[model samples]
Target chain A: MSLRRRDFLKLTAAGPVAFAAAATLPTSAHASPAPDNAFDDAYGVLVDTTFCIGCRKCEWGCNEANDVPRRARTEFDDKSVTTVHRRPDATAYTVVNQIAAPPETPQPVYAKVQCMHCNHPACASACIVGALRKQPEGPVTYDAWKCIGCRYCMVACPFQIPGYEYAKALQPRVMKCGFCAERIIKEGRKPACVENCPNEALTFGRRRELRSLAHQKAVASPGRYLDHLYGETEVGGTSWLYLTGVDFARADLPPLGSRPVPELTEKIQHGVFKNFVPPLALFGLLGLVMASQHSGENGGK
Target chain B: MSPTFRRLAWGIVVLSALHAPALRAQKVQTEAEQRSHMEMMKLDCRQCHTCESPTTTTPCLMACPRLTVAQSSGKHVVSEAPESMVLDKLADQYQGVQFDHKLHAGMAEMNTSCSTCHHFCPPGKIPACVSCHSIEANEQNLRQPSLKGAYHRQCMNCHREWSHDTDCNVCHLPVGKYAQAHDKTDPTDIMGKAHPVVVAPKMKSYVTPYAKGPVVTFYHEEHIELFGLRCVDCHQKENCSYCHDLSKPQAQKKTMEQVHSLCSSCHQNAKCSKCHDTVERPAFSHASTGWSVGRFHSRLECRACHPTGKRISKVNRDCTSCHGGWNQSNFRHAVTGLQLDETHASAECADCHENRHYNLKPTCAGCHDDKRDFKAVPPGKYVTVSRKR
Candidate 1:
């Protein structure tokens, strides 16, 4: 009744092979279908760069809401801070950068940088563990418990929005703008930044609606705005749209095509393993090899 | 049930379902037919419906975009429109904003056009903000703003110019606060609402922090009365925060360049000492610079003498600078309140006048000495001229 060394090895080998085989079984019917239109009703914010006066009230509001330590209210009035271009970091979820205006624009144009909250977020796709997720509502949220501190989301983001808690020794989380999901869904309030904007430069609404509004604004004021809306098509249409008088590139926004970041990788992945064929075949071969090893060992004994 | 009975029952149910829409259509057609002959003649069917043969089920009504420009007579718009309105759409968050419609209308007409506020007015009547914009935030169309946002945008457009502060309390009361907290009893009633008349200050003196020239005197009333400058001329692009909401953040210390931008159009910024004087300077007067704009010249525009970009001091003060070759024949002595008689008119030009400066009084000492002075022997008939200065 005692187990032999060879038998024990065979049992251990069979475990992974069997598990792989089971994982590869076809379940197309149960597979959740990709959404027909992910951004149909998702909330979005349209940021009109021309209207932003670089007041930095949004930054102050964000800090106050998120409980980040900041300087006094009077210190926020110092416009000299805008001289340097800044990126979102662990302390700041959003930062406004003043860009040199184009010839058409009368004054310096300011662009707010934050997570775009794309419909098909690359960060979600890049996360090996299900840490980063594109919520049904518009935010690309993070689950710190699931995160392994891989820093893949940071590299995957086209805007380089996600920041890692490199300083934390344990349980580091990826940080980015959450679009005030809790306030919007539970409290029924606007995002702190949107509420604090004096000029109403940022408009919060449904993604689909914001897209058309951005278009209409650009059309209505021919010379006032650049014809293109930044997030309308870039990286499969982000939730946070932008209207700028200058080219988006000049405003420190990355130039990206309309294709979603996950599209190319998903195509290659699905192509290699369509209908659960290739993975199933590999598992089958592994199982056969393990079975042959068990038989060969028995015959030798 | 028998098969034939079951079949007949199903047939009746199917027939009734099919006929329901047809019956409704017939009723609608009758209603359309019942229209008066004159009413039918007035409107073309295509005006409301897209198709030639529109029925109740497939009416194919055209969507009214409501983008047409509104036309209204100026007189009717003022008379028929309400004097004020209570914008209470966002009352849950803040008390209703009482808009003084008449005051704004009058101000807008004088400064801008009526179309500034009545942006989407149709013929005859002013349209409500909701006519174009939706009341609900979740409305499908995003082209126009929600009613709350539209109202704020319209009001802020002009309000921000006078007051830079965007504090909601400037126009609304906090949630639970009574409107009677202020002098006005009813916030909605604007019948007696009037902005306190803005009195022009005679002068404004600024003691600047500048180490060099610290005092700057701005002649406010003189610029309006004497210089004939409108309020908007210097107050262009001013925000409401400029006068209201003093608690708001003070404007940052202005640079020399920023300080000069205000009056650079009229005065030369290169001459900084002119404005930034060490001591509080007196109000600007034409006489302070040596040439006095007398009664006859008070009504003339500055450009008549200074011309474009010409310094005020650069103008010649002598009468001959403007009226060249002014001898007895062409001089029209009657304009001076004394018409010269034939005897004195034929005298040399320098006999009575000390210098060519018309501002100096004419003396007859050179011609007749103390024996027969200008008072003893009148030069001509005296004319009473009402001088404005």
Candidate 2:
């Protein structure tokens, strides 16, 4: 009776092991669908930090357009808020932080922070249920319906942009800059912050064109801008680009390599489970050994 | 037969000898012909040519001095140049901006002159933007902007002040589409229209939140027209958003010290009551300040009497305050609108008046007791009252 029980347990375990091996086969066979090419013609914004005057008009415009409850108009003009470095949160999708310039520079520089909208987003890869997707038009969109209240995207973002609505227990969503995707794609308008910029500090156009323009500006005015165009190559390029007079590190930007974050994770995953043969063969051998043991027990009986 | 051949050979020899000198002279003339006609007029080649014996190949003429010479004295009238100019040096992505040369020149007459735009012009013609600014990015000299940057900076500097619009489409259209889109009217034609007169405000009042002095009245027109001050004189570094942005709150709270700096040059800010008052202050009048800048002093620049680096109101208003030791000998008596006659020209200033106040009517009692009433005799006929003073 014991021998029979052992045989039944081995057979039942083999069924689940075979199923697990087959699940990873398709993913290992093909690479993440060759990162969608839809973002090729997508638009981008070039933020020339030197030109920003720290007026906080972009903050006001964003609040009005996005329907984010805000203080009085007079409160926005209070520039004392820039004394401390602030980040995008549940309430605000974008925030402008003032970076104090060195004594050699004329004035302090203001940098607007928001989602970078990476070309190959790690956030989309981290989502277990396909809740997050990088849109063809350069916006990384999130579907609240598909989300299972997992904050995986928050952890995956290199810029640390995604904010979670922790206060809402019923239906929480990840919040970040959507690049005004709906306004740009459907309404044929520039992003609210970009439109509100009085100084023309933020130039919105096709990503390729803006890249060339950023390079041209840097070349034209040496020393006025740093040699590197931020986001041009970092994290395999991003929709938003930046030009700064001082080092990007001083402006609170993180130094990152050109390789996308998803590339590293995907490469490791694919390498270990190439063709799913290793896991499948190991499980098959394990099941066969258990079956032999059960047959030996039966022979003893 | 031998004698006849000898005579013919002798004739040929004579003709050939004569033509040799003529051929040599023609060769020399051709060599000199290469020299410009102007070069021939200079009897002394050393004046321009550096070398002792200058030839066509090594004339070694002095480098042209026209560039330096033209900087100080070149005066090309606006009408002499083209009415409009198309700046297309860096027009790969955007259509070249149309510059209305005539209209800008006309408007420039108000404050600035032709040199405002023709900054590096030559003697007879306006130089192109590329003349001073290099078309390519010049790494060696980063102080000067490249041609594209230079053009944009020049246009946007002034355009940003008035229109406050920096949209690329405002000044630039897509390449190859501008001409077709503009159709009957060119960019220059639109730009050629005169800018609407920027009306100077007669008065402006600012109600500050300060407890000491909340209200500040600014005599804008008086400061501009009467004081002969330009718009940029006080409004230096003013951003357009200060006036154009309606969504923004009121001007940021400026410290009392910061507000004073703006008027420190002309007015004494120490006197808080001068600017800050409960009611609107009347337009500034010299008479109200105890000394009227009368007809004679009105034409003089404020700096002429006040001198720079000092407040205008702080300077002494008395005539003798500036003209230190005024008497008969050194003083040009006619400047006071009263030309001294032969009788009084040599007379001492103390002879006619008891008090030295020149503004007070002079009493002829000391010099001419008989003509005690000076109304009977004028000092002299005004010496054509030279307005040059």
Best by DockQ: 1
Question: What tens-digit string does per-residue lDDT give for candidate 1 at B193-253?
Answer: 5966556689999988776898888888877776667665666533333455455556688
Tell me the fnat of candidate 1. 0.13
Task: Kindly report which residue pairs in candidate 1 clash with one another.
Answer: B70-B121, B161-B238, B161-B239, B161-B240, B162-B239, B162-B240, B163-B239, B163-B240, B163-B241, B164-B241
The CA lDDT of each predicted structure is 0.71, 0.70
- Per-residue lDDT, model 2, residue A38, is 39
RMSD, every candidate, angstroms: 17.3, 17.2
DockQ of 1: 0.10
Q: Against the true structure, what is model 2's DockQ?
A: 0.02
**DockQ of predictions, in order shown:** 0.10, 0.02
User: How would you encode candidate 2's per-residue C-alpha lDDT over B134-155 as one tens digit per residue?
Assistant: 8753434333445665676566
- Largest TM-score belongs to which candidate? 1
How is the predicted docking of candidate 2 categorized under the CAPRI scheme?
A: incorrect
Residue A215, model 1, lDDT: 82
True contacts kept of each: 0.13, 0.00
Give one digit per residue, the lDDT tens place, for model 1 in A1-301: 3457787678667755554445444422334333235785888899988777676878877887873446455456566777698899877888888887655443456788889998889999999998988888888888878989889889988889988777878776788888888988788788999887756788888887787788877786788888988877787788898998887685568898776887666555664566877567657775876687778878878
